[model samples]
Target: MSRLRPEAGILPPVSSPIAQQASFGERLRALRQARKMTLQQASKETGVAQSTLSKMENNQLSPTFNLMQKLALGLGIDMPQLFAPVHEARISGRRSVTKKQQGREHLTATYEHELLATELDSKRMVPFKSRVRARHLDEFGGWVRHEGEELLLVLEGDVLVYTEEYEPLPLSEGDSTYFDSTMGHAVVSVSKDDALVLWVCVAQ
Candidate 1:
């Protein structure tokens, strides 16, 4: 899919005092509609109940990691797609902090990320919770871009994501964005507070 161009005058990064207002549930619904699939079709494919799917789409249910896998597989997407970033109203900086409980393995010193699903290694979709401290550019220095597109949901603070084509995508709480890492990109938190984000890197 092609990317939408960033709007003029970088949007001031979003700042939110409250968390859990993100559209995680709405994104799932958007994907389902975009694919022209019905709830029954997905439920049948995943062997899950139709009512369960409804609750999920309605944002009434918080899905477990295992259940997330089933939904992603049924939708012909990798597990990370469920939380993939969506282009938002262009904004420069956004702020919101979220503390997540993730798997221990994917956590890095500079960036603490919980692995949503191990299938990322093979499925080419790696989902992680990224926590970046201020002035922590070099912390991500160890990162090596392998392949795929990266999506981020800014949980808190400001992240300056630099790529080749355009300037950094500064995202904040409730904001989301996507980028291809082939051109070499890095995420830096310019905010005084810690920058927390959810990243889904997909290699297609």
Candidate 2:
């Protein structure tokens, strides 16, 4: 059965106790149509075929993980949020983050951090910790940006951050700086030793 919320386009795939039996395909089709988009339009945006999407929506074909990922991204939904349980539809106004417990997502890096926050359901400020390497310096690439002004503090060791115009500024442990993040900026290790810093970015 196809179910559509007035504003929500997706449905529970199946009525399983754990997994929602909602149809990603049907939701995709309905969402596309609701957005005044054609199958061809969705295909252009998601790189999935119109026929494939049609088949999946009609339950003739089951969407693979990759297909659902593409569909979720096209629909502007987080992968996990899209497949969230029916019983727990929206987590908003339900719980609060405690001081000892902050929601976090971690990736392959040197240390721990409270990663990017949920967009609309998130707090204003986001914090991330960059830990230095003990063996050698990080293969310096550049600073990652989202939307914010950042104040970076050298929590430990030495750090050098450079903007496109000015030369790299070296800051020792306990030193800190605040700057506009619109410009192209990158961070590197100033010393042959490690460099760890705490970054607090305020959302706009």
Error of 2 at 113 (Å): 4.7
Deviating ranges (above 4 Å) for candidate 1: 1-100, 107-109, 119-124, 134-144
Candidate 2 structure quality by residue, lDDT tens digits, 86-136:
232456565433343243322223233333333323334545566544232
Q: Please give the CA lDDT of all the candidate structures.
A: 0.58, 0.53
C-alpha root-mean-square deviation, candidate 2: 12.8
Cα TM-score of candidate 1? 0.45
Off by over 4 Å in 2: 1-105, 108-121, 133-143
Each candidate structure's count of clashing pairs: 13, 7
